[model samples]
Target: MVDDDDLILEVAQMSLEVVGGWEVTTANGARDGLVRARAEHPDAIVLDVMMPGMDGPTAAQALKADPETADIPIVLLTAKVQSADRDRFADLPVAGVLAKPFDPMRLPAELGSLLGWT
Candidate 1:
């Protein structure tokens, strides 16, 4: 998971770890996320849309651009709940888009559904 907000990162990490029983790696920003993504090669990425310097879409592009991370599925997490906002990613190679302020307990289920994980 990658997010600029410390609280979100912590909550998400804990939620995924405890509830989902998934090993999660996190980065605070898009640049760090790219680096981590390359090194760790996580099964999927939970990326935040709004951030300083590099946004989620740009980061997803960078991830897809490199062969090392190209195949990894990306699920965008955003505060923008509008369909138009979600439609912007139709051109990108993303698995799905999830709304922000998500239920911590259900996050794993939602993400798993998106990633087609049992």
Candidate 2:
């Protein structure tokens, strides 16, 4: 997961680890997240839309542009919950979006569904 907020990252990490039984690595910003994602190649990425240096859409584009990371699924998590915002991501190579202030309890399930994980 990549988020500027440490609290969100921590909560997501805990939820995915404890509840989802998944190994998670978190980065505080989009740049770091991209670096980590490149190195680690996680099963799925949960990215925040707003961040310092390289927002989620731009980062997602870069990741998709790269053949090595192109197949990895990206799920955007953001507060930009507008109709246009949803439409903006329609053509992007994202798996889905999860709105901000999400229920921590259901995050794992949401991600699982998005990634088609059983």
User: Cα lDDT of all candidates, in order?
Assistant: 0.94, 0.90
Error of 1 at 75 (Å): 0.4
Tens digits of per-residue lDDT, candidate 2, 4-95, equal: 99999999999999998899999999889888888999888999998888899998998888887888899999999899999998877899
Off by over 4 Å in 1: none
Which residue pairs in candidate 1 have backbone atoms (N, alpha carbon, C) closer than 3 angstroms, thus clashing? none
Inter-residue clash pairs, candidate 2: none
Total clashing pairs for each candidate: 0, 0
Off by over 4 Å in 2: none
Error of 2 at 11 (Å): 0.7
